[model samples]
Target chain A: AQRVTQPEKLLSVFKGAPVELKCNYSYSGSPELFWYVQYSRQRLQLLLRHISRESIKGFTADLNKGETSFHLKKPFAQEEDSAMYYCALLVPGNQFYFGTGTSLTVIP
Target chain B: DVKVTQSLRYLVKRTGEKVFLECVQDMDHENMFWYRQDPGLGLRLIYFSYDVKMKEKGDIPEGYSVSREKKERFSLILESASTNQTSMYLCASSSQPRGLKLFFGSGTQLSVL
Candidate 1:
């Protein structure tokens, strides 16, 4: 079974503090990991994909195949970064498996 | 920019009523998907269509069906709406089998009374 797990339901951090949102997956085939964020009163949008290896909004995610993890990280947390983050895994077909999500709150 | 648009922003239906949730994409994407967003459950795929007249059942396809009559339009159908089926329905579209970046709509908040 293919699954995506986001252990932290809610994560809080002070402004300027580093932030990390953990994401783990269990898949037999090659996994395509993605990070999606939803701001308050906004639609869900793609944050980044592991394949692109690009950072958005000063946030980055590294896919550690050895540990089956694709954790999202930001050097410094900003108040605007507070939102719901979702980790998604794409199977062979265009099917997606998303985790429960982690709500990040950056305090000032 | 790729745009996936959902017709209804909010909908209220009685129990056992048939519900139609329409979605249209202007990007001419090859894949379109329907997902339900709940508090604890991030997003659960209800159904997806790869191409026109082609549909596939997603993780939670029960009590739900999908229609893709044209390349730009995908419709999610609920044969009998129930209280449990009430959710924030999201419509998304991706380029192809790669499923790289998914563009999502604002979503429809459905309430089944």
Candidate 2:
């Protein structure tokens, strides 16, 4: 079965602190990972996808195929960056599988 | 910008009532999806349409149905609304099946009374 796993339900860090949201997957096909963000009282939006190899709002996620992980990283957390982050995966020719999600809080 | 728009931002309905939630994407994408958002569940796909008059059941399809009469629009129908079905309904569209982003709507907050 294809699955996406986000181990942290909530993560908190002080301003300017580095942040990492971990994600792992179980699938047989090629990995296409993505990070989505949802701010308070706002619609969920795409942050970044591995295929593009681009960063969005200082956030970047690198796919580690050896470990089946796609961890989202930010060198420094900002208060405005606090929101719900979801890790998702799309196998070759398949629907997207999303994890439970992680609520990140970048404290001041 | 790729835009996916939901017809209603808020709706209130009673049990056993039929409910229609409509969505439209301006980019004329080939795929549209309906999902329900909950506190802990993240997003669960209710149904998806890849083409006009074509639909597929997603992870959770019971007590719900969908329609896609036109390429740009997708409709989610709740045959008989239940209190448990009250959720933040989200509509999404993608450019393609491979390496594409899912643009989402603001969401419809449906309250089944």
Candidate 3:
């Protein structure tokens, strides 16, 4: 079965520090990966997709097929970056499997 | 920009009562989905509709049912609300070609007493 795993349920980092949100998937075939974010009192929205190969809001994710991972990374963490992040895997059937999500808290 | 609207932002109901959560998308997307968000479980798909009058059971569909009588609207129903059903319900839509890129609405937080 296809599954998306985000091992960390909570993470805290100081401002200006490096941040990385881990995402790993279990799939046999080539996969489409995406990142979604939900800020406080805001609607859930798409952050970025691996296919686009573009960074959104200073964050970028590279799909590593050999490791089956698509970890989100930012060079410098910001206070506004605190939010819930979810990693998703899109399979052949137009279905998405989402990770448990990581709650990121950036301390001042 | 696509807009997916959910009917209610918050709701409270007694156990055993029937509940309906409505969702409508304005982008004329071909697919709509219902999911429940919980603390450790993440977002679990409850049901989804690919077309009018067509519905499919998602990963967790035992306690819920869905109706899609119109192409742009999807409704999620709970036959009898229970405490376990109290959750944050989310509605989303996507087009056929970009089916994985979802547009979501503000979720409805339902509480069953």
- For model 1 the interface RMSD, in Å, equals 0.8
Q: Can you give the TM-score per candidate against the true fold?
A: 0.97, 0.95, 0.98
All candidates in order of lDDT, best leading? 3, 1, 2
Chain B TM-score for all candidates, comma-separated: 0.97, 0.96, 0.97
Q: For candidate 1, lDDT tens digit of each residue in B1-113?
A: 99899979999999999999999999889999999999878899999988999999888999999899999999999999999998999999998757678899999999999
Calculate each model's fnat, 2 decimals. 0.82, 0.61, 0.74
**Chain B global fold similarity (TM-score) for predicted model 1 against the true chain B:** 0.97
lDDT of 2 by residue, B28-81 (tens): 898888989887887888998888999999999999999999999999999999
Worst 10 residues of 1 chain A by lDDT: A89-98
Clashing pairs in 3: none
Q: Which stretches of candidate 1 lie over 4 Å from their true place?
A: none
RMSD of 1: 1.0
Per-residue CA lDDT of model 3 for B13-106, tens digit only, reads 9999999999999999999999999998899999988889999989999989999999999999999999999999999999996596999999
- Candidate closer to the true structure by lDDT (higher is better), 2 or 3: 3
Of candidate 1 chain B, the 10-residue stretch with the lowest lDDT total is B94-103
Off by over 4 Å in 3: none
What does DockQ give for each predicted structure?
0.85, 0.67, 0.80
Residue pairs in clash, model 2? none
DockQ of 1: 0.85
